[model samples]
Target: MSEVLLLLLLLLALGPGASALPKPSGQRQTGPQRNKLLLVSFDGFRWDYDQDVETPELDMISVRGVKAKYITPPMLTMTSPSHFTTITGRWVEDHEVVHNMMFDQKTNLKVPHKETLRRTEWWDTGATPLWITAQNQGLKVGSFHFPGGGAHYSGQPIQRHVFETPGFPDDNETEWRENLDTVLDWFSVEDFDLVTLYFGEPDNVGHQRGPDTPERKDIVRQIDRALGHLRRGIDARNLTHNLNVIVTSDHGMTTVKKRPLVDEIILNKYLPLLKLASFEILDYGGFGILTPRPGREAEVLESLAKVPNITAYSKSQMPYSFHLGRSQRLPPVVIQADLGFNLNSRLIVYVNKGDHGYHSGEMDMKTIFRAFGPDFRQNVVSQPFDSVHIYPLMCRLLQLQPAPHNGSEEVTRALLVQETDGASRLVSSLLLLVSFLFFFV
Candidate 1:
């Protein structure tokens, strides 16, 4: 068979669900403003949030554009790693951002997530992100409070970026609108080809008021209002036809189960914390990492395995799907709690009613994914896929050659529209022509 036929067969067989790479397509950067993309992330939006609260904006977008059942995040799902996975199209293993906090194994030091954003060493760990890849291809890009936006990757920073203040009000509608307007201006005035805007939402309220609370429902309404404002801003700038918008989140939140209802994994109760581990990152939401002392690896794993409502895995023994075992930054052993339970250190009380950071398989751990634009199919609901696939979709929408990433274009290509389908048709036509020539000649 001709190479074209063989390639076409491969794409047909693999493009819908397999880890297929996207072909750089007919798209080119020509005019002053080429194909533009806007990525918006509302932190900790569960897949079922709209089902609980009336989200007219999200509903309207689904009717007019594309929606996914949900998107699965990388295991040990947290803000930094999941967001990095979405933008870099790499698992935590490839991107090496395994946690929300940056932990140093040698010094046993851990930096908070916001402070880690400015730590170049943490973000510049050899993986190139979408912004840097686009800029390298001569596309102007910007970021608004997205994770890793403040750091340099491959010695290149996003052309324009903003960071939220350490203590910004999470639910202020006015502040959210201001940020949305600024992003719109970046596209209309500054001509950014791609921009990532993040909102620390419903995530904050989810944690404070619990995922099952009325407070979370209220915050969801606030988030929907912000989405409406985003739509209005895009329309006001005459960018409706030029821009593609993807709104998603890092991870979903679940209600935390306390004692008497379910036994939380309090590590110090099972193992002598001071005796076996050199460094312990615990009392967090749903995950913990332990660096065993020079000779106590086996003991630490064994003791942790005995903790109720949790699973313990040595680095190599982690489930292959977790995609976290290969990072040198990760600890020797990792512990993850059941969906609603959290891993805790002895005497460190975690009072938050809702939390995340569990493995991503649980229904409650799956998050939202919605996209709308001139490039997406209207009223189509796609199947759930991993968050990693998003990076390649953005690359295709912007017509930029993607950096090294683990995402497959096949899974997300179904959500796209005429241009993407036209590319597929062109490939099929080429295959037929090549086959005819090979057989007749």
Candidate 2:
């Protein structure tokens, strides 16, 4: 009788029907089951933009989940490269998306962001994106206007994606709502595990008027209201408990006060030296790449180094911290403009009042990152982390095995609740069943 009583007590302690047992010291407890994840990106949303704008929806999310003070984007903080890095968890060098407009010397191909949708070679190289990884693991994935959404990877595109229309302005409010509604519709579909939504707002307006201008603030408020609508829709459908939502930006914007023509400095001033170069690609305002003539590499580097407000580096001498020199698409000589300066051609007449693609170390180039859902701790504020860390967090929330990538678990693990072991739970269930049989017999 004593043995039977002991068995009953043990079953009560270990049974699956019992509440979760206390975890051993130093063992982290896992979060609740989070089967759905939604990632949203606001283009060029600066880290501090929220402070000046009234973002009730974002505030609610931060109060409910976790918000990073700031997130440092990868070097060459351009839209396409930063977005790809955020999804792939690798630096631009490793991912091979060196810039927004990439020129490949071997194929003599110039692939721009819009054209990249159909060009597999541009995005399919290096690490696979989160969407592809999730889809391969049997989770249905969908994207609405997210970068890298249209690429056909592993012989398949995202299950449902809205491709950007060529030359169509993406800053319209109506278009933004339509895209958000489409993503919400996707969530209602059967077994949709992951969905990505993008909005090109404040960035478009920021560029036209300047990051600190009143016009930019108004646009930010407009975007905030739109997000509120999205939140209400999710709540209406009772998905707030099941979906993990993350809101971030590709990069942040900085004011561009001067536009320096690259030709005046590189071509005209150093014409004799530049003529020796085989190709010169000065696509973005912040960075320039020069593919020198076979033997004139030293000459090109020397001449460009003399240009003011521009720092030039030979491929081998590029900073290790930037992690930019490894890709074949990189030129022999790379040039970066100092903060607040735009490097352009003499033929170009107009420049946006605001721009990005500056060095990542600039605070103005930092962006926002906030997440709210069952998988995250409520009311938590974390220190600034690199945007690359987000990839691992996404994998964890979706309960998928992360592919081998540059992201570190140590960087993002603290933000997540340690999960309990399923095996332990199974053993508890078996013990309870045996105890029940003995008692009944």
Which model scores highest in lDDT? Answer: 1
Off by over 4 Å in 2: 1-32, 106-108, 259-267, 270-274, 345-350, 417-441
Expressed as tens digits, the lDDT of each residue in 276-324 for candidate 2 is 6666666466677777788888877777767777788888988998989
Clash count per candidate: 0, 4
What does the lDDT come to for candidate 1?
Answer: 0.85
lDDT of 2: 0.76
Predicted structure 1, TM vs. truth: 0.90
List ranges where model 1 is wrong by over 4 Å.
1-28, 260-262, 419-441
Candidate 1 clashes between residue pairs 3 or more apart in a chain or in different chains: none
The local distance difference test score of each candidate is: 0.85, 0.76
lDDT of 1 by residue, 1-441 (tens): 566666776666445533222346444566533468999999999999999789899999999899999999888679998999998999999999887888887898889888988888888888898888887777788999999888987677789889887787878899999999999999999888889999998899989889999999999998999999999999999999888999999999999876652566667888999988888888787898889999999988888778888888899888888888888889888888888887778774788889999879988889999999877889999889999999988887787778889998778887877545666666776676667777877
